[model samples]
Target: MIKTLLFDFGDVFINLDKAATFRELKKLGLEDFSSGMMEQNQLYEMGKISSEEFVNFYISKIPESNSKKLIIAWNSILLDFPQHRLEFLQQLKEENKYQLILLSNTNDLHISWIKENVSFFTEFKSCFDAFYLSHEINFRKPNADIYEFVLEKHQLQPNEVLFIDDTQENTEAAKSLGIHTWNIDPNTEDVVDLFSTKSELF
Candidate 1:
């Protein structure tokens, strides 16, 4: 039986712009056009450094950009939380029908930004039996080891866990481990749609 429902935070709970950072970088003149600096980001997510350090690193790469503006743009992926999704997750939590877990590959600054801006961060987070972040666990998505960490740590059966993520590669990684997955397209699928589809799975 499926006893756990694992959700990805970014697109599942909150909305984010995929291109916001790229646009912001152009404005800041980052010079290096690498996609999302995932390496440095992984370091920050692992709790190896502070958000200030992460922001400063990016700022230093920009020659004469406003640090504050660059910081905000870098954080622009975090958008407003849609109410229906929160309500759905809240209902699931109240029912206590499954082991709810939230797993996201996010970093310190992004986390700090959400903590300060998302009014329901505490309440929403409280709903999860385990809230796992790559930085916190020193693991990130698209890496099989992180999935192994969760399975081993929680003593969870991969078949019993359903992972939801906006990114296909991450979902594919989970699928490789025999975990069921839903690749949610934020521009298309809404969490409310997940209710019917997932219910059928059970």
Candidate 2:
């Protein structure tokens, strides 16, 4: 039986324009995102580097871009957190049907923007029994270590955990560890439909 639920923050809850950041960077003259740049992003997401260093890495690449502009461009992917999702999450929390845990691959800047812009962020956070952010935890999704960390930390059996994420790779990785997974398509799937869509699990 599924005794615990793990959720991804972006796309699953807060809406994101996955292409916005790339488009925004292109406007700032970043025509190509090099492998080095990608590595830096992963490092930043893992909290292996400071925010100052992250911004500086961009500034060093695009000398004309300032910290403020870089930050704005980086946060372009983030969008509003819909109220309906928040309500659904709150209802689940109140039901106390499962151990609700939030596992998100997020960085400091993105989270800071959400905290500043999403008015219900704190209330949404309160719905989860444990919240793990990639940067804060020094680990990220699609990585087995992070999944192992969550299972070990919560003392949960992998078979008893249900993980829901928008990314197929993430869900697949979790499934490999014996966890039940929902590789949801954010464009069509609404988390509120959990009961009807995955009724068998519940």
Q: Judged by lDDT, which candidate is best?
A: 2
Q: For residues 126-199, what per-residue lDDT tens digits would candidate 1 score against the true structure?
A: 88899998788888888899889889989999999999999999999999999999998888788768767677
23-75: candidate 2 lDDT, tens digit per residue: 98888878889999999999999999999999999989988889999999999
TM-score of each: 0.92, 0.99
Each candidate's lDDT (Cα)? 0.84, 0.95
Residue-pair clashes per prediction, in order, are 2, 0
The superposed Cα distance between candidate 2 and the true structure at residue 180, in angstroms, equals 0.3
Residue 38 C-alpha lDDT in model 2: 98
